[model samples]
Target: MFIRNESFYSFRRQYPIITILVAIHLILFVWMNFLPFGNYIRALGIGYNLAVANGEYWRLITPIFMHIGAGHVLFNSFSLVIFGPALERMLGKFKFILVYLITGIIANIATFYLGGLAYPPHLGASGAIFGLLGMYVYLVINRKDLIDRMNSQLVMTIIIIGLVMTFVNPNINILAHLFGLIAGAALAPLFLIGAKPYYAEQRVFVDHGEPVFDPNRWQKKRRNNKRLKQAFWIGLGILVLFGLLSRVL
Candidate 1:
């Protein structure tokens, strides 16, 4: 009910990364629970600290798609729907994807090293979800004039509730959430600048019957679409290199 029609109509078009992410999560969840290969998929994707320590470093990334049960995936998917599209619209698809992946992997890494090797191998996308929430919090704080103060306050409330939930769920890896939030905050400077000039000006307008960030910022420095693209590839490369190193060393 809170989502605007324009935003909803343009969600898939403007936020393809969010769509792809939700699709992947749903597909994996369904494949793991309904299909004959469910167990195999779970075995391959679920994170296990010992497995990671043994050089199965893919665990760092794969667990973002793994869930313990219906409740887990449902909660995460709902959170994504609420937060992902807006962030994607602001950061553009490529940069948003990079933020997601970087924070998520870092969260999992934190879990691996600090989660105390508990049972069940800590899985799910809560860390990444928290990352988006953290990013939103960052934006709300740094770009206060650009965002509605009321909305920012609401997000702050939700973040606090989310954090509390992290603690309430004994099965949840609080470290992952904490680290992911920290990573999102640290990485915000790389992404808070929009790919379009409107992003800098915090303006919006209709473009070819669709809405986009202000294209009339009037400053050449305000429009830098390459920043997100470049950051995406660079961050991806770093994650890949780190994963490989985790496996080798």
Candidate 2:
């Protein structure tokens, strides 16, 4: 389910919600890093507890699109790209965006209230990304028919890795990650009522009227992609170990 063999144009056409979200991520990242008022824009968007307490309520919504650094935005955006399409298809565009935004806003609200004076200023799509993860976890638990065995296992593994990283990483908004997960899981039943599992054969658009998959080219790319996926999983496994050891000894 995680593999995206579709062409760039094809993927964009099929998953406009993911496409628009990634585009917003990139655009906002660039805007906050390159333009003259970059710092000003970032300051206005970050989930600063002080600012939120001062009645800057938009901070609740803005931080979902406002990342702190290159790694922050890119990692969250990559996770969204990897995992979002299925839900976008299952929930349809409207519910998908609704879950994302609501869960993110909930996380920011927690950061505002529970955070108080101790919480550092925070910004990133991590909350929303965790929200998506939470939805998948819900599918794995309560809606087995909506997900295959392989994806269910994969979701379990990813959830473990995400939990490890959430605790291990310094400067993380623990409230956002945990609250977002809860909110998504809580909201999943409502939003995923009529959702269906994603399949590779659903739709494959042609690139400018030409087939996107050529036999030989497809084989080569698949082989390379397999290797990359293997390495990625191994790396994540190592992270789980490292995180446990760090906490234990």
Candidate 3:
């Protein structure tokens, strides 16, 4: 439950879940295209009937990490980078991860039950990103004090734009987006009961003569989370280096 209550810009440590997720996606993307077992990884993509009927129920979760192409992955990654930290801080690490997984799985399930099997294999983090946006919208609606008016409007505008795109584009996975949004909003209450608003402004306080940098319970939790975050990034760096070395040799 480590929630770094600081501005996104002021955030010093890498975000644990977000860093690991993006790294995993990038690694998988490279594996699915550049390395062996490319075909097998592509086959792992979620197809409604194919996934469920074949007893590959894990597709419900795995597809959240798979993207169809460069454009698709970039868009979702950008969205996560843009909005994730703020929401993560608000909900705390535990709740933020819980909301993400729950909404993502729900979105996939919705697609599985409602989508036409004729459509291309559904893959990407768009659903989960939409879910995060939806959760923000819920926070804006129910707890206006937790977010400023401008930021709230920005979130609402994104949702509005997404809704419009869903209707306008035939290729879009409207069911996944819709379900993700609903899932995010529906699950918001569970994380918001005692949530505090995060401010983009950082304040420094001093007691007597020294600057206050005390490690309270929450700060200790945050420190531990940061260590985990660093570990993931280090692992990602090593993986990338190995991949590069292999390519060279």
Per-prediction TM-score, please? 0.75, 0.83, 0.75
- Please tell me which predicted candidate would have the highest TM-score against the true structure: 2
Candidate 3 local lDDT, 42-130, one digit each (tens): 78765454657568888888888886566566667756766788777778888888888888999888887777455457777878888
lDDT of candidates 1 onward, in order: 0.71, 0.82, 0.72
Candidate 2 backbone overlaps, count: 0
**Each model's total of backbone clashes:** 1, 0, 0
lDDT of candidate 1 over 100-143, digit per residue (tens): 99999999988887775663577788888788878777777787
Task: List the RMSD of every prediction in angstroms.
Answer: 11.9, 5.4, 10.3
Which residue pairs collide in model 2, if any? Answer: none
Error of 3 at 228 (Å): 31
What's model 2's overall lDDT? 0.82
Candidate 3 accuracy as TM-score = 0.75
Per residue, candidate 2 scores C-alpha lDDT tens digits across 61-95 of 99899865666676677788778989998999999
lDDT of 3: 0.72
